[model samples]
Target: MIRTFAFDVGETLVRDDRYWASWADWLHVPRHTVSALVGAVVARGQDNAEALRLIQPGIDPSAAYQAREEAGRGEHLDETDVYEDVRPALSALREAGARVIIAGNQTVKAGALLRALDLPADLIATSGEWGVAKPSPAFFERLVAQADVPADEILYVGDHPQNDILPAQAAGLRTAHVRRGPWGCLWADDPTVIEAADHRIDSLTDLIPLAGQ
Candidate 1:
């Protein structure tokens, strides 16, 4: 039985429109341009941040991020940034006696912003806080330890195939691929993603019944 439901933040519980928009503003580039570049990189199985590097060659994303933070324009999340299904889904799962956790590859500031929203989750964490990012076995190792349960009893849900589904599966966690974001939609039908994910969902609400099973 899946006793714990762990969610990925970006494009899973939250929409990333504001994130890319912020970057566009930071770089003084058109939002659509950044969007298109992001799509192109994602289609090529490249990192989403590659779009930024494409915008400004030799740019240091970490340095840019810190500069944005200094300018008071770093990562920000509000209720509007969250998916409509997130609250109800998380609350319902918690109400059903399932452990609800929100963990993903996000900055520490993103973690703080997520907590400020007060979503119905038992725990919220990020890669920055953990000092480990996804697609890494060590990251899932931390998650497994935090869940304090057998990895198979924990369901790791995300919109990224490589970072979420494959790695989580390799770490012994049951995986769910949510087809909402660009990567999710593009790769949803791929044999690899389909074969890796134990469940394919379009919305967080879809997991409500899955938790009961």
Candidate 2:
């Protein structure tokens, strides 16, 4: 039985297309440019920070982030910003006696943002808080430690095959690939990648049955 469910944040629980569009606006560039840069980075299997650097070589990321945050103060995720299946799926899991958590690679301020939105989760942990990030054994170790459950009893659902699925599986957690985000869609048709995940889902609600209820 899967006693605990840990989900990746961006593109898993939240959609970030609008945020990137806003970044294009802030940078005074065409929205397509932002999209193209991000696509290029994803094609190369690079991380988000690297994408930002490649898009705007001399830009100051911290300042840009602060500006975005300041301009968007009081702006938090609305129901529409989340995937349609998140709430219902989480509710089903919680009702079924499963512990649900939001675990992802994000800034220190992300916990506050998630709390303000009142997401349905028992715990929320970020790389900033743990001082480690995904694809790293230490990060998954921290999650297992916090969950206080055997690795085999934890199920990690995420979009990234590399950072989320492979690492968690290597760490002994059951893995699920949710095919909605760039990473997920990119590797969706790859036999090796898809076959590695214990479950492949198009919607979060698919997790309900996998969690055994």
Against the true structure, candidate 2 reaches a TM-score of 0.91
**Candidate-wise lDDT, in order:** 0.93, 0.85
In candidate 2, what are the lDDT values of residues 1-213, reduced to their tens digit? 899999999899999777677777877889888888887887787765566787678778778888778887322456677888888999999988899989998877876777677778999989988899989999999999989999999999998888899999999999999898777798877786677799898999989877752
Question: TM-scores for all candidates?
Answer: 0.97, 0.91
Off by over 4 Å in 1: none
What lDDT does model 1 reach? 0.93
Model 2 lDDT at residue 59: 75
Q: What TM value does model 1 have?
A: 0.97
- Candidate 2 off by > 4 Å: 70-76
Best by TM-score: 1
lDDT (tens digit, per residue) of candidate 1 on 63-168: 9999999999988888898889999999999999999989999999889999999999999999999999999999999999999999999999998888899999
